[model samples]
Target: MQYHYEFILATMAVLGILFLFTFFKTVLPIRRNRMFRWLLVAESVTLIFNVLSTWYNSSFGQVPLIVINTFDVLFFIGFVSRDFLFYCYIESLVQERAPAIRLPRFLVWTVVEVSLLLILTSPWSGIVYSINDSGYHIGRFYRLVLYTNAYSYLLFSIGIVLAAISRNVLARIERFSLIGACLILVVGNIMRMLYPTYLLMDSFYMISILVMYLSFQNPDLYIERKTGLLNQSAALSILQEFGKRETFSVFALVLDDFSENRRLYGVRQMDAGLRIIADYLRTRYPDCFIAYLEEGRFMLIARQVLPVTTMCRDFDRRLQEPWHDIHVSLYLTASYVAFCGPLQVERPDIFLNYVATALRRAEEENQLVVIDEQERQRADHDAKIRAAVDWAITNNTVEVYYQPLYGTKEQRIIGAEALSRIVDPELGMISPGEFIQVAERSGSITQLGEQVFEKVCAFLAHQDAVALGIEKINVNLSPIQCRDERMPERLLAIAGNHHIDLSRFKLEITESALADRNVLQNNMKRLQEQHAVFSLDDFGTGYSNLMRVLRFPFSDVKLDMSFVQAYFSRHNRLLPAIIDGFQSFGVQVTAEGVETREMARELTRLGCSILQGYYFSKPLPEKEFLAYVARTQHDPEHTIRF
Candidate 1:
């Protein structure tokens, strides 16, 4: 019991030191905030009262009886007055618009004042706590005094929580801490009431105030240092509060070249520039709360939508004039993403993503601001595609279609091209070209590649390819997949697992992708060592002409149909020479889109050994393609007559 008293004294001392440390830790903020100062003084007074009451009661005869009694009375008054002081502090924290304070302000405080009047008169009736010549003794109704004050505050607190339930507009962490401290206070008081020998209510009430101060009262935790704007967490918290309203908009501004400017100006000078920018933003929208997100990103909360186009144009007009300070002068490009809401309250991050992505899309497209119906529609469409692709990948519903690639000289089917297609029960037949990029963007391209490859390999394994004279089945690997270091080996593993030889499958890489031979070149080389064949696909479409083609270690080049169409329209005789040149370089040439029998005959004469087009067969399902193979072998030359 003696050591327990020492611990109590020691804890109170530590609590005072904590308050002092927090006070100095955020000296500038505390200096500006008088209510916060009163909070500290009130807590300190209550702690001093507790320590004095403890000593007065214990050393009853050692000290003067009257002095001890006076300490006891001051202790009870301090204990009771703190509740009103804390209520004022809490009322200040609440925003004026909050519904909890809808009641007449003076009326609420008046009731608390009358309760204090009853508590103050308790000393006369000896109801709260009393001091006699014997010692300081707990009054008969001491628990009533503690509960009445606590429950009154508790009722006010509950009103605040319910009012702000839709969004945490209040000092949420402090509110939570207050609730927890109240619960503990109630529990501690009930236990002490059950056993009248113990005195725990004062210590527990001290805890209630201490919890709020430490958790939510610290400004440094939520205020940005350089700009003094609400920090990232505070900004988001307040934004959620604002989001609860019916109509609000956010201007998500990203200061372009932020890191570059930081590098040029140095950290300290950059901070000064940011403060200037933050101040400018505050001036522009004086009533709005501006939040400085990390690395030159800032968000503004506006209760109503503004003309985004006009505002952004002015932003550019002002910023383009050049920002000049003592140390740095530069032109800064800022991008804006704005969204008016009936926001997606369930998914708050998505609401932000919609706006932030518009800014990114605008900057990327070299536009000023791209927050229009089309941009939002694109985001929604992409979200649908992502969800569809995710479902296809999960359910293994991704279908592989086979288009037959034929040898011109052999006049029979030589290989089939495998393309993954998605025909969602709802989204009906999504083109791989469209969804493949979606997969890449969503970082599910690898899974998509593996899914397609598994189907292709399984199809090949199921085929009587040797009997059909089908030497290989060409598989298209997305450029994103090719960039993966393990993609080649991973694909080889898939083929090996399906008991399909690497030689029986050819992975097609776009000519544009192969231009950077310094790239996934090693991945291809590793695959080549394992006898996996590679082909340059859509050869003519890339920026680089024969230069990328010559260095590429492809077994062949699949000419794009565009060249065939061009040849037919323009009657370019050079197409024959191009084919011969490719063949001479030891890369086999294949003519794509060989629609007419005449085109096929001409390509054969031009030294192109293979032809692939809808003329032979459009991309067919697995069973249909196998039947096509049988039909092709029987009448290869006459399948499509000139």
Candidate 2:
């Protein structure tokens, strides 16, 4: 049979180009990329040996029997290994998306080993192929090996399809693309079995390689367009692999005033400046993995501990010099953070969070920040707390605790303040101060505040606070929530759902919330129309003034705990002066943090009509708060002594 070799040569040429590009240009040390490069190598070797076997077989007795046997055995070996390599490449893709789904290595390797054994002994046993003096002949077991390869392709397709269906991480297009690659190989296998003289399988290999390359191995997917460097996605993938298997170091570069520079230089010039920085890192540190995390953030990762002091000094000096080639000598201020560790963390997301936090600290302190073990632990704890906050808000499990307000003259509970709390199953009793800030930073405060308001209204609907001598309950509003123009409407809707009276609820606002006077005024007006009372909370701590206080229609003003403690410690005249100034405007004074009898008595004598502190009662759950209110009704002054 005369075999056509033109198509085989052409396909090999194309495969060679792809192999070179994948090896040299797109060598991202991610699992998928490495597996893809392996597939390319396997395919190229298979084609080269297939072409050699065809040539030697065509010469017949001209070539030595040893040469014929060697080329035929090598060709079969490459052929059998090609399907296993394809399976490995798909496994890499699946594992990347669903890291938990591990295909058993032993089962597949067992079949591959048996196939190789049959091929290795084929020259003597005639199990796979035989190169006699006449020509190369398919042995009795050649069909067996071909069928095994076909089944392997079928198994790979089935597994990829299942992974696509089960793992939401695998998109439909990606799953189908993987299955398509498998189907192409299967079809090529069938054609080779049917027409052995066509030499068509290599062409199919090229097509399959093209499909896999476009689907997963394309360099553009992992490169940032603006800076032409490895992107955030690539960095995360590499970091995830390294974090699992090896020790590494990460040097983070954050532009301190990226926004300011972009505004001054315009988008195009700033992007160009970023590209220049990326190029500098790439050229200066060829051994390091460079990634651009957009908005003037870049990362250089190395397998060993970087020379922190020297590298930072070099980068600092380079940054100090003005950038050339731009119309203006573009000046960029950057903050650098270096981290070296075994970093025994399982998830790369947490490590990336640590990097982000470290970058922020470096920018704030205007110095290089080398993260120590304590900082790493803190960052890990913060990530966990943030995740817990998310879980609480998402599950609507945020609890509300009430702290009772004591009227000086009445000497009983007048009202209570509702505080949000989360008791995580794993992390018990997270501090309100800690989780509240996390919620606010993560923009979950809106949902958190809404849940608290609903729970408070539910409490009012069921508990009968008025009968308990509690006139109103104070609910604090987050500044982020207050900024929303529809905050009043959302709160009212929640309250209205439970048929609670707004007049019985005093919405507390912080001094910081007053930064946006227009939004605050609008929200206050809308809520006030519903008979909601407004109070200035934590006053005399932030940027508080009588004028700012009077600007908003606050029916009550609460002195900050710090001021109360300071007055008790130093007998500060400013405390009484501020109290008198607030009282003169007919804004009722409520003193916070009256932690002792003396502080309480002095604050009461200072003409504060309302007193709230640990001395009276610490924040309590609903049942305890109601029980305390009931006790205060009888022995209002001595019910709960500090």
Candidate 3:
């Protein structure tokens, strides 16, 4: 029996030394983690108290034995406090960005401290344990008091896991770790009470601690160190775990105008703002779990659909005041796109992707945009158009369709505007109006514009334009082309390579393009110097300052079809005056969409210099447009609608 006691002591000794070695080896920079620090203190105090109690249990002298038993009870009382501390550690590990479970901290601690006070002062009263002549002996209510307190801590630990799961906060692995740790202690404590003589409870706690160390310690890899929030990978894990069910809403929050802030304050100052943002979310959004996505981006998961009206009000209020916690005073705004789930989304990646798309649209328009059926269809359409445009650009199959710009005075095809048409073998013909927006958004306009210009050059090289009495060929320039610094050189090279005269080319720009007067003037001057003409296209469709646009060196301005058709009956309102003003400035005016010969006769009477519409010819392929030009120029008596 003495040898049995010695063997038990040796086992405790071995375990004690092992814990100390592991502590020193694995706990570097451990002070930074409050959870691990609480855990360390709890385990250390428990290990020391348990070892001393076992050794001094059989000491001979009654005085020493009484003191030892008292000291052991003091340590035993301390274990009750450690139980709550252990629960605190676990709570911190699983808390994520918000409160996981609301245990009344004040009430729980009060009950625990009161229980501890009873156990510590038990020697005098012998309510928990008493020292006697026979040996250290147990009090009558020992197991009841001990277990009741221990079970309270167990209840807390279990509460955290269940709350996290029901809220859809934890991934599968997180659920496994938390549940496994609680089970180990629960089963181990039952065994300890059943076989009191055998020392199994401490070993069970150590095993649970080991499980937790492996589990919670990995958070460093997935958490943002600056703000202590989960990063994208962990956020994605939560989404994957709960995306299919109808448990929660995921929100994508974009920091609007973040680039402007970064430019003004620099990166260090922006980081300070971001940290404050993390803290702010923790307070204001008490029920949401947050993930630190890329810079100026964040993901928030909550138990139900967000009150969009409330959030919008808050958003407005936040922007109305300047916050001072950052490096400088800052006013900010955010775009919130909610992922309405259970019915709309079927998978995590799809939910995140849709949220991203909605957020982008909101940011672009500087407003709140929802991802509904219309938005989804628009996204799918844009994607298809983008893919078809990419394939068209790669294959060099982009075709140029020419609409004849007939000089009404000549009553013949004098020139034509080169419009790009995409005729794909797979998708068939894609309208210019549909794919042009896609090209602009994707920044593929530069490539697509160059290809169209090349196709126009190829067409001119194939046609006998000078022999066919052509004055010029107009090519539409996108806003993206207007901004490109290399536009003049690239266009000149393509025309020169095709041996077409630059004087026979006209570049049509929108009225809005002239808003940037300086750059547009520079590019236009360079092209004008090379003997090319500039025409303002779709003139009255914008806020056309006719005087302001004529001030630029453009030789012609095309009248928008809407104004021409609107004034066919009501001709004296503004159209006649606008056309006279352009012709007086030596700027030729062309009226397009002359669907009726009545519209054409009225525009010709209004002193419009040129006419273009389906009444003369719809936009035609390269070979057919040249044929019409050749046939009309030769047959001077070609029957006019007049």
Tell me the tens digit of each residue's lDDT in model 2 across 256-330.
877667766777888778878878989999989989887678899898778878888888899889776647568
Q: Name the lDDT value of residue 529 in candidate 3.
A: 89
Each prediction's whole-model lDDT (CA):
0.71, 0.83, 0.74
Highest TM-score model number = 2
lDDT of 2 at 49: 88
Ranking by TM-score: 2, 1, 3
Q: What CA RMSD would candidate 2 show?
A: 6.7
Candidate 1 residue-wise lDDT, 1-642, digit = tens: 231343356547656776676667643222113455675576566557666767667767888766766666666666656665665555544532242443466756765666566556755677776766666667787767666765676567555555555466546565676568557656755765675434455466557666766766666778898898888656655655665678877777887867666755677877877888888888988767788877788888778786778878888898878666777566678877776766544444445556656766766665655456677677776678778999999999889889998887776788889888888877788877679878876789889879988988887777678888889888887777777787877887888899887888888887646634565789888888888888888877755466557876888888888977789888555687777777778889888888887887878877887889877889999889888888767775546444
Clashing pairs in 1: none
Question: What stretches of model 3 exceed 4 Å from their correct place?
Answer: 1-304, 309-338, 342-370, 569-572, 635-638
Better of 2 and 3 by TM-score: 2
lDDT of 3: 0.74
CA displacement after TM-score superposition, residue 8 of candidate 3 (Å):
40
**What lDDT is reached at residue 153 by model 2?**
53
Q: What's the TM-score of each model vs. the native?
A: 0.61, 0.68, 0.53
The per-prediction tally of clashing pairs is 0, 0, 0
